[model samples]
Target: MSEPSRPGPARRSRLLRTARRWTVRLVVALAGALLGVLLLGRVEAPIGPFDATVALRPAGGGAHLDIPPLGALEVDAYDGPLQLDLQLRRVDEVRAEALATNPVLLDGVVDQVSEDLRDAVVKVSWMTALAAVAGAAGASLLLLRRPREVFLTLGVATGLVAGTAGLAAATWRPQALSQPTYTGLLVNAPSLIGSAQEIVARFDAYRASLEDLVANVGTLYSALSALPAPGGTDDTVALLHVSDLHLNPAGFDLVRQVATQFDVDGILDTGDITDWGSEPENSLITAVGTLDVPYVFIRGNHDSAVTGGLVAAQPNATVLDDSEVTVAGISVVGTPDPRFTPDKDATGDPGSLEQSGEELAEIADGLPEPPAIAMVHDPRQAPPLDGAVPLVLAGHTHEREVTELEEGTRLMAQGSTGGAGLRGLQGEFPEPLTCTVLYLDRATGALTAYDDVTLGGLGETEVTIERTVVGPPAPDNGETGTDGGTEPTGTPASPTG
Candidate 1:
C-alpha cells in the first residue's frame, strides 16, 4: 500500500509539469503570430495600367488584351462581364474565371499567394509554440531532477533565445511577398505565365536601349548646367526639381551626384519615389535616404497610386499631395495627376481621369498670398489654373528637357530624374535626349529651357539653349515696330504690367 501511494504522488507531479510546459508553448506561439501580422500588414501591392499598355494590346476575343509583364489580363467594358478568354496570351479567360470564382485573383497575385502562405505561417507559429512548451517541460524536469541541473537548463534556454531571435529578425521582411502590383500577381504561375523567351528578349533589348538613352541625357543635362547663368549672379534658387522617379535607383544616383556637384541649395522630388506607392524598404527608399540635403517631395499620379508609403516613412521630407509648401522663397502648390477609375477586373472600361482643378482653385484661395511657382503632374492640366498661377512645373511627359505648353503660362517638363527611363513600357524613351526644363523666375517671367548634359559616358549629346522671340516683340509702348524696321524713336517696349 505504501509503494502504490508513492507512485501516485510521482504521477501527479508529472501531470503538473506537462500543464506548465503547454502554457509556455502557447506564449511563444502568440509572440510569433503577432510578429508575422505586423510585418505582412506593411507589405505593398503596386497597381497601375502602365504595365498593361506596354506588354499587351488587343489581340483577339472580345477585343481584349494581355500584358505578361503585368499579368495575363482580360480587359473589356466595366459595366458587365462579357465574352472573355485569358490564354496565357489572351488574358480574358483568366479575368472571367477570377470574376466568377475567387475575387482574390482580382486583388492581385500577391494576395492569392498570401492566402496560401498564411497556412505556412500558422504552422511555423505552432512549431514555435511547441518548442517553447518543450523548453518549459525540460526546465521543470531539470528542477525536479536535482538542484544542480538548473544551471544546465538555463544555458540551453539562453541558446534557444539567441537562435530564435536572430532567425525571426533575419527573415521578418520578405521581398517575395511584396511583388504583386495592382493589376495582378507579378509572380509566374502556370495558369497565367506567358512566353519566357519573349520576355527575356524584350527585357534585354529594353536594357541596352535604356542604357544608351540614359547616358546621352545625363551628359546633356550636365552640359546645360555648365552654361553661364543668364545673369552674372544666380538670381534665384537653381536646384534640380524632379518627380515620378519610380524605383529607379540609378536615376536617383545621377540626381544626387548632380545636386552635390552643382551645390544646389535644395533638391525637390515632386513624388512617385517608388514603383509602387506603399513599398518602404526597396531600392528607392534606400537611395532617398542617402541624399544629405533638404529634399522636398510632392505626390504625383503614380506616387499616390503606387508608392505613397515612402512619404509616411520620411518625416524630414515634405509631401505635398494636395497641399502647398514654400521652397527656396517660392510658394508652390502641388497636386497629383487626375485620378483614374481603374477596372478592378482588368476589363477595359477606359479609366476615368479625376483631376481636381476646382480643389486646386480652392487651395489657391487659402494661400496667404499668390504662389510664384506651382508643381503639377500633367502639363495639360495647367489650364484650370489659368491667370491664378504664373509657373507650373510638371514631369509626366518626360520630354527630353523642356517642352513649352500652349498657354503663355510657362510649363517645365522635368525629364526622368530616375526610374525605368522615359521610354515607358511603350519603348518611347525620354525626349530631348539629355535635357530637363528650368525656369529662372516666375515673377519676372524668366525661363531657361535646356537639357542638363553632365553625366559623362552615358551617350549624352550636347544640348544648346537658344532663345527665339516667338511672337512680334511685345506691343512696343502702344506703337508696334514696322515689319523688320526699327521701333519708334526713344520708345522702348515697357515690361507687361
Candidate 2:
C-alpha cells in the first residue's frame, strides 16, 4: 500500500534516487574491505622475543648452551646433541680452532624476513574474517531495498581475500636457497694474535730444518770422496744459492762473500728475497747488483705479488713466475704462493688440489731436462714433484730452528737470512731464510748444494761470484771443504765466514 501511494511523481523520484545512493555506498564499502583483506594476507611473521648462545666443545663432543628462559641446550658434533660429559663439552668448544667454522650464517626464511610484517599478517587474518562477516551483514540489510548493490559488495570482498591469498602463496619460496647478501671476516682479534704466535712457532720449525740442511751440507763437504776436476769452458759454472735474504743489506753482504768464496758460476736466489714483494729495489736486488752472473729467483709468499713483476725487469735477473728458464744448460722452475686459491668450486663442492699442484708440475716440466730443481714458497708444495724434478727448494716452513722430512725428495731450505732471524717467525712461518748455493754440472748433470753465508754479520750478506767444477777430482778452485762436506773448500773471497 505504501509503494502504491508513491505513485506521485515527486515521491517516486525521491525513492528511486535514495535507492541509487544506497547502492553506490554499499559497493564502495565492499571494495575497500576486499582491498584491505588482500593487503593483510601478504603480511609475514612478527618478531618474537628471543636469545641464543653457542658454546663449542672438542673431541667430537658437542656444544653446551645456557639460553636461560630458553633452557640449557647441548649440541654435539655436526651440531649434534649436547651431553654433560666434559669431553663432549670440549668437542663443541674446540670449534675455536677452525677459522671457517666459528662464525656461521643464520638459516631459514623466517629468520631472513622482518618480524613486523609477520605480526601484521596474523593481525590482518583475524581482522579480515571479522570484516567479511560485517560485510555480509551489511549486504543482507540492503537486500530488500538494493539487492543488486548487496550482491556486488559480497562478490568484491570474496575476490579480494582470494586474490591476496593467491599472491602470497605464489611469492613464497624457501629463503635458504637465496645467496648470501652479507659477509665478514670471522677472525677475532685475540685469535688473530694467537695465530701470529703459531706462525712464529712455524717459523721456528722452518729454522730448524735449515739448520739440519746446513749440517748435511757441512757433512758433504767434510767427506770428500775424490775432488772432481773443473769441467766446462773458462765459463766456470758458479752456484749462487741465496735464501731468506729478506732484502736486507746485511743479507746481501753474506751473499757476496759466499759468491767470491765458491766462485759461483750462476746464482740461484731461493724464496724470500725480500720481507715482502711490495717494497721494490730492496737489499735483495741491490745486493744482487754486485754479482756478474745470471740471477734466477723464485717467490716466497711473504713477497708482494706486485714486486714479483718488477723482479723480471731487473738487470741480469730472471724472475720465475710459474715458469721456467734455461741458464748454464740447467733448467729452473718457479711457483707463487698456493694459499691464494680456494678449496671449493662454484657448485659448493670440494675440488681437486690438482688445480694448484698440476699447474706447478707443469711449470716444472718446462725445465730443460730431467733431474730438475724446482723452487717454491711453501713446503706443502714439496710433495708430488712429478718425478721429473728431484730437488725441491722450499722456505715457508721454518723448522722450529732445524728439522727434516725423511724419505722424501731432497728439500733445501735456507733458514732466515735476516739479521735478527725473527724473519718470518710467525705461525708455521719458516725460520730466518738461510743462504745456499746450488752447483749443477752440464756434462754429467750432477748437482751439489752449498751455503757460503751463515746467519751472522753484514759482510756475509751480499751476492758474490761463485764457481764450481764437476768431474773426477773436483778442483778446490780456492773453495774449502771435502766431498764429505764440512765447510766450503774454496778460499773466502769476500768474508762470508
Candidate 3:
C-alpha cells in the first residue's frame, strides 16, 4: 500500500481555493434566497369581510397585525429568523354598509367571521409556501449563473423556509397575543385581544352584562321618548350633554340610546370620563367612538393627558384644550382644568382657577366667531367666562344645577352621568345618573331650551325628565341664582327601571 499518497503543495492549495470558493457561493445563495422570500412571500386572501394580506419577512420572529388608519399591533408569538405580518386592505362594501347601518349586527355574524378567518389562513399558507419557493429559486438563478448551483440553492432555500416555519409553529405561544404592543389608534388592543381560553371566558361574561345593561337603559329611554314634547322641536339642533362618566360602561350606553332616540347632532362631554386616566382606563374611551355622533370633550380633574389623547384619537371625537370648534351649526369653546386631582392632593398647572378661567375667556374672545357655549369641568372656573360666551356648561358636584352669573351668562352644571362613579354605590341612597339635552335655534345658535334627564343609580333605574325653557338673561343681575329665570314644562310620565 503506497502511504506516499500525500498531495503536492500546489494540489493542497487548489483544494483550499475550492473550499473558499464554495463557501462564498453558499453565503451568496443564502442572501439571495432571503431577499426573494421577503419580496414575494405574501398572499392576499379574504379574511371575514376584509381583504387582507398575509406576508412572511426577514425579521425577529413574531407576528404583526395592521389595520391601516386605525393602527397596528405586534406580538412575540414565535421564535425564528422569519416573521409574519397581516394587513387589512379593503373591506367588503356590502358588509361594511350593513355594519354602518346597524353596528349591533356584528355580534350576529361572529361565527361566520371566524370561519372565514380560518379559511383565509389555510389558503394563505399554501400560497405563501409556493411564493417562497419560486422566489428563492428565481433569485438564486439570477446570482448563481450555473444551473447546478441554482438547483442546489433552490433546494437549500426550501429547507430553510420550511424549517423556520416549522420552528415557529412548534414554538408559537397564544398567550403572547394578550400582551401585544400597539401603535396608532389601536392603543387599546389589549381590551380586544386577551389571552386564550380563560380571558375569553371572562370577556364573554363582561360583554353579556354590558349588553344587558345597555338593553335595559335603551328600553327606558324608548318609553320616555313616548311622552309628548312641548312642540316647536322641528328645525332645532339637538345636543346631548354628558359629564363625569367616571368610566362607567352604562354611562356610554345611556349616551348612545339618548343620542339615537333624540337624533342629537352631537355630544358634549364636560370631562371626568375616567377616574385615573391610566392606559387601561383609556380602553373605555372606545365606547365614545361607538356613539357615532360628533363628540366634543374636555379634561376633568380626574383625567390626564393619556385620557385626552384616547378621546381625541376617536374618528368622531374632538378634544378641546383651550380651543374652540363648531358642531352641528353650534360653536363651542373649552379649556382643561388647572389642577388634576388624581388623589387627595391636586397637581398640574400652577395657575389659580381665576387665572385659568380668564385664559379660557381670552381663548373664546380670540375665536373667529363668538361661541354658542363655553364648557368647564368646575363651576368655579365659569365666573370670568360669564361675558365671553352666552352659555356655560359644567359638571363636578355630582348634582345637576342651573345658575345665572352676574354677567348674564346662563350656566347649566350637569350631574354625574356615571351616578357619581363607583363611589356612588358607597352612599346610603343611590345617586342619580344625569344628563341634559340642549335644544338650540339653528339660525341663531342660541340655547332655546333643554331637558334634564336623571336616572336612578346603576341598579335603581327610575328615570325622570324635566323640560325647562329659558327666558332671556335674568335681567343682568349681580347675584347668582339657580333659576336663570327659566320655567319647567310640567312633569310628564317617566320610565321606572
Top candidate, metric lDDT: 3
Compose the digit string of candidate 2's lDDT tens values, residues 154-204: 665566456544644554434421211111221121222234345445444
Candidate number of the best TM-score:
3
Native RMSD of candidate 1 (Å): 18.2
lDDT score, candidate 3, position 175 = 86
Q: Which wins on lDDT, candidate 1 or candidate 3?
A: 3
The deviation in Å at residue 49 for candidate 3 is 5.5
**What's the CA error at residue 83 for candidate 3, in Å?**
0.9
The parts of candidate 3 lying over 4 Å away from their true place are 1-29, 46-51, 67-72, 88-94, 102-105, 108-124, 139-151, 183-240, 243-356, 359-374, 377-380, 383-391, 395-434, 438-497
Instruction: Tell how far residue 194 is off in model 3, in angstroms.
Output: 9.6
Which parts of model 1 are misplaced by more than 4 Å? Answer: 1-184, 187-195, 202-226, 278-283, 338-355, 400-407, 419-439, 442-497
Worst 10 residues of 1 by lDDT: 49-58
Output the lDDT of residue 67, model 1. 48
The CA-based lDDT of model 1 is what?
A: 0.45
* RMSD per model, one decimal: 18.2, 20.3, 8.8
Per-candidate TM vs. native? 0.48, 0.41, 0.58
Q: 443-487 in candidate 3: lDDT tens per residue? A: 788786787887766345356676676554345555533444543
Give candidate 2 misplaced runs (Cα > 4 Å): 1-236, 280-286, 339-355, 366-368, 400-408, 419-433, 448-453, 457-497
